[model samples]
Target: MRKLNWILALVLMVPAVVLAAGKTELTWYGHSAFKLTTPSGKVLLIDPWITNPANKNGKEDLAKLDKADLVLITHGHFDHVGNSVEIAKKTGAKLVSTFDLGKALATYGGYPEKQMGFDTQGNFGGELNLLDGEVKITFIPAIHSSTVVAPEGSADKDIHDGGNPGGFVVSVKNGPTIYHTGDTDVFSDMALIAKFDKVDVMLACIGGHFTMGPKRAAEAVRLVHPGMVVPMHYGTFPVLDGTPEAFGTALKKEGAKARLRVMKIGETLTF
Candidate 1:
């Protein structure tokens, strides 16, 4: 009876152990904003535009974000930099960005000066081992414009050079690797991403006008070959008319094998 009880206890613990292992939580706050919680519970915010127009609960979500370990910005666009200053002030999250963009934000964009430094800043083709090696982030290039304009009514309300636009390939220890493609068009170099790492999830922009549309984005997926693709940077305004339906049709036409996971605004998914 004692031996049987011990076996049963071990069986019961298996599920809990598996649940605790290899699990990462991802939350979307509309547009290109995402919150990634690593397996060890370290929180990383990417393009943390928590108050974007697509999210109905933007204010509430922004208020609830009281804990963040890192705040990563892809460029200097107002939409992408949304709420970074506020979140940094509230959570004391360190800024991860290019040296130029970090300096511009700290000097003019109102991000806490102390939160950004060389330890967290890097340029394209550079990989940063952050959070005590819980996450490895590689800076990826994007073909897009970047410029930082100080907040309206601020003393130095002028446009500043924000370095280059880019993306991130975030590899989490014991968890999935994710690629966040910032605003960009289809480029052949995107194929290089798969050569280095196997991406489990891809946060892609499918919006037209400013970024690639569904057709072009599907082509990009074919090049990167991620396990799953999440469409974003769309539907926030009337100008961004790309829809998931179009993206899906384009994916099928492109014969891309990646599974499309379209997340709703304010939705959370665990991987």
Candidate 2:
């Protein structure tokens, strides 16, 4: 009887152990900076411009960050490239980006050359199984321009080619599939993203002037047909005038089925 009771207790605890082992978390640092914590505790930063103007906790967040597995950059824009070098150096985080962008960043953006190599770099339509296969990242194309120039230099200084811009579709094992739009205008091919994998969440750029506005973003959302949408890359500058309220309204008009999740700065959403 005692042995049977112990066996029952162990069986009962198995589900709880599995649940705890599969927890994932996401944290936003305003603008486009986001940190993804996998169930296995691997940290991935997406376009980690932690010091952008919209995030008041930028300095604190950057300083407190201790461990990061991968730092992913969408483009070479100053706003998008924020704090990645600092974070990578401090944490020895490997960089995940396009081969072209990785070369440019290492040569000019001050990224440690050893940290970014072919191991974590890929081009559009390429996929990488990383973090012990706990996360599968697929590169998706984005319509945007990228330029790399020396910071704090004369206006006429040299501008380096930053390569093609793109986004990422991160599929977490036993978790969710997250699609980060990066910075881009809405294009027709977005409809194909959902065909490959059902997008659980989309980190989309709703800001105008540089990227698509709310109306077009809603269209993009409709195309991808994700389970939920999280608006990003808006209101960091005066020119980026897109608003979440407007995005919601547009989504409604476009008949997009995804739910909207407007996260407050420094707040986290767990799954």
Top TM-score: which candidate number?
2
> Which residues of candidate 1, in runs, are more than 4 Å off?
1-22
Q: Model 2 misses residue 150 by how many Å?
A: 3.1
How far is each candidate from the true structure, as Cα RMSD in Å?
A: 3.1, 2.5
Q: Over the stretch 1-271, how does candidate 2's per-residue lDDT look in tens digits? A: 9999999999999987985678889999999889999987899999998989999878999999999999999999888888888898899999999999999888888889999888899999899999999899999999999977655553536789999999999999888899999999999999999989899999999989999999999999999999999999899999999999999999999999999999999999998
Best by lDDT: 1
- List the global CA lDDT of all models: 0.93, 0.92
Give model 2's TM-score versus the native structure: 0.93
Query: Lowest-lDDT window of 10 residues in candidate 1?
Result: 14-23
Per-residue CA lDDT of model 1 for 1-271, tens digit only, reads 9999999999999976875675799999989999999987899999998989888899999889899999999999999999999999999999999998999898888899999888899999999999999899999999898999887679886789999999999999888999999999989999999999999999999989999999999999999999999999999989999999999999999999999999988788998
Task: For candidate 1, report its TM-score.
Answer: 0.93
Q: What number of backbone clashes does candidate 2 have, counting pairs of residues 3 or more apart or in separate chains?
A: 0
Q: What is the TM-score of each candidate against the true structure?
A: 0.93, 0.93
